[model samples]
Target: MTLQLDAYMHEKKAWIDSQLPLFLQETSIPGKLKESMLYSLMAGGKRIRPILLFAALNTLGESEDKGLSTAIALEMVHTYSLIHDDLPAMDNDDLRRGKPTNHKMFGEATAILAGDGLLTFAFQIIASDPALDGDIKSRLVALLASAAGPEGMVGGQEDDLEAEEKVLTLEQLMSVHRRKTGRLVGFPLEAAAVIARATEQQTHSLTGYADHLGLAFQIGDDILDIIGNEEELGKPVGSDLNNHKNTYVSLLELEGAKKKMADHVDRAVVFLRKSGFENSLLAQIAAFILNRTF
Candidate 1:
């Protein structure tokens, strides 16, 4: 069956959106904290990480149900990162997805706590899933920790902050984003591979595809920051310039960055073809990154 990328993305995104709120309905969570967490978690975006997990599962010939808990967990972590990223101490942005950022709406302390809660709860969700065996749960937990922890997203964020106002070589910039943005983006595919019990070779191919896809995604983001409409992005464009942050656009110029993004997308497609997922929805997603508006 030919994959309709738009329909596939919509269906998977809807599934993730419905599942997200249900995970936070526990009575043990304090009402205000729950509200704050849900505020950012439900904030609208493409839900790309969770959708990628489902797409990877499908490409690996596994049922999406097998990765349901992991998908939700991934989104929680992603949202948590966004909450922290928007804190006054961090990006200091007031808008996300067309609404006030969590800190702006809930206060900085609550927003910090909300981010903390989501980050911790994400691991708990994977650890406590009834359908996964102990071994799979352990693997999932470890991978999530590595991806969201200091070695991955957190590390990249720190590097990005430190690099502010300092001109970075292209290699240096890529290194920072590989951790800050790329790790989380790559995690979905790796987590799905774990759920599907894929062979070593299959996992390798997916990981390769993920690495290039992650770079392509970041490059596209850099381009969008310069050219995207604020209404469409739900936030101000050129904030990178305002903050003096080095980006692909800053380092490579607009046209150079676009060409570099295209290069990564082409390489990503090669890995997908090697993995025999060239016709899968994952391939379509790689293509979409080339022209994404927000």
Candidate 2:
């Protein structure tokens, strides 16, 4: 049977969303802090990272149960990044997922704390899981930290900030996003490979798939910023342009960006085929990135 991507996405997203609050509730955090954290964490967005983790697990013939904590932790870290990225000193956005940003709703201090809390708590979730062995936990913790930390997403953010208002070459732009966006996107696949004990050749292929998919994702986002509906996106469109940010669209033009995104999607699917996951949901997701509206 052909997999229904929408239904599959909705199911996975629902599962991730349901688990997020339960994990938060397990903590003995202060009431206000907890509330602030939950507010942003529960805010609606496509839980793509977690879904990707689950999808990777499925592709590896592993049960989704094995990746539950990892998926939740990934989402928590992603949510934390969004909360901080929307802060006054950052993107300074007012809307996120169609509601007031965390800082806008809960004040800057609380938002900052909430982001910090989520980021730190993510590692704890992985570490404290009784189901995962110590070695697995250690590996996950190291991988997650590296993906979300100064050498990865954080470093990419620094490059992005520095490149603002200045034109960047396509190579430079790719470098910035590879760390900031691609690393996290790639993390799910790598983590899944670790969990499933995938062979080195399989891991290499998945890594190749991830690199192209990550670029496709960013290119799609850049295209959406130019043409997507504000209501559908929940956040304002053209914010990239307003910020004078160099995007795939800005650097390559609208049609050029679209073509570039399509190329990456094609390459991603080829890698999936090489990894023996050609017909899996991972391939569908690459196609989704090619035509995503949000």
Candidate 3:
């Protein structure tokens, strides 16, 4: 399953690489700025969000060519988030994916510019794609903006910073993670529905599925923070503790967090079943999320 997922991910990775530059290269930025932005944007991660978007589109019977714009755009937003999160004002990390972080290599100012460029370019990538109808493109643009904006991913990040030294209840912790991380995951599922012209019912089911996947992914990340090593994770472990940000596993205790993740995975499977996602690869993807150490 890992082999299959890895192979599939490679295909999407190639697609993203070829198209991502088109978005950033046209921004009229200096050559070096574009280089730093491209460097971090091209750096390897799971590519999970873009892959999930493509997988959802595939099951909806959309062609990859038609989905390419969204696939790349979502990846840009994700990469932008990581570049900013690794900044000194945020995670203050020096390493990511076993390389110097964006700020470390580019200086804080350039790194900030690169991230801003990526974020703005993500919308442009989606807006300019000829694959989607004007109405659908508009909808997706609004969807992404809201999901990544103050009400969603950014809001969650702020909450995390404020929760420092505060003992978050399980619900509070869930709130922080669901937004900071979960909405970004959910956006792809919703995007697939929009692109495929799915019915309201199907969209609803897919959304629930995405929500479960998103939250479960966060729980697994929490567990990794406790058990994972920095070399394996490509970042420092226990930084969450050092930063005093609450996580699902942190609040629940590791045993309880494991149990909660089990529940989440099960619920996600149920939603996928209802949505008729019979793809074995997605099933294996579920297991990967549950089992990943970094």
Candidate 4:
């Protein structure tokens, strides 16, 4: 199953990488801005969000290609977030994807603009996608906006920053992660249902799977921060500790954190099974998130 997943990820990542450049090439943005945007966008990572979008579409007996526009926009939004997250004002990271962060390479101002460009262009991509129905495109655009907006990922980030100065209880930490990470992660799955016009029951089931999966993914991230290798992580490990952040590991310890992560994955898998959509691929993807070391 691991080997199969590796193959699947390799193929999907290659497709994402290949198409991303085409989107950049078509953009009319001026020289250095375009370069800066491309630099971070091309920075290598797991490409998990876009893959989730594809996987969700696939689980609905729909072609993954049907989700390509949404997938591309989703990756753009994710990359934009990463670029902003690494800024001097945010997490203040020095490296990402094994290279200097966007700010380091392109100057802080340019990096900020690059992130803005990606965020705006993502909406444009969704709005302009000719393949999807107009109603579908409109709904997707709204969903993506809400997921990336101040009330969601950005708001979670604010909470995370606030938490750095204080001790966050377990529940507070969970709320922070659900907003900061879970909502964006779940958006792909929800968008899949929207595109597929899935039944209300099916949508509800996938939403449950997505909710659990998102939380599990963040728990896995918190666990990895304590035990991960810097080389594999592409950024320094232990940043969470250095920042005095309260993570699942801090709250529950390593063994307890792992168990909690496992519990979420179990719940996610149960929901996936209940979704009844030939979800072998989606189940593997969920496992991949929990088991991922990097």
Q: Give the TM-score of each candidate.
A: 0.98, 0.98, 0.94, 0.97
Flag regions of model 3 displaced more than 4 Å: 25-27, 278-280
Error of model 3, residue 235, in angstroms: 1.3
Better of 2 and 4 by TM-score: 2
Give the Cα error of residue 274 in candidate 4, in Å: 1.5
**At residue 163, what lDDT does model 3 achieve?**
90
Query: lDDT of all the models against the reference?
Result: 0.91, 0.91, 0.84, 0.89
Q: Candidate 4, 221: how far from true, in Å?
A: 1.0
Per-candidate clashes, comma-separated: 0, 0, 0, 0
Give one digit per residue, the lDDT tens place, for model 4 in 254-287: 9999999999989988887776753577889878
Off by over 4 Å in 4: 277-279
Could you tell me the TM-score of candidate 2?
Answer: 0.98
lDDT of 4: 0.89
User: What TM-score does candidate 3 reach?
Assistant: 0.94
What lDDT tens digits, residue by residue, belong to model 1 across residues 11-39? 98988889899998864899889999999
RMSD of each: 1.4, 1.2, 1.7, 1.1
lDDT for residue 111 in candidate 2, whole number 0-100: 95
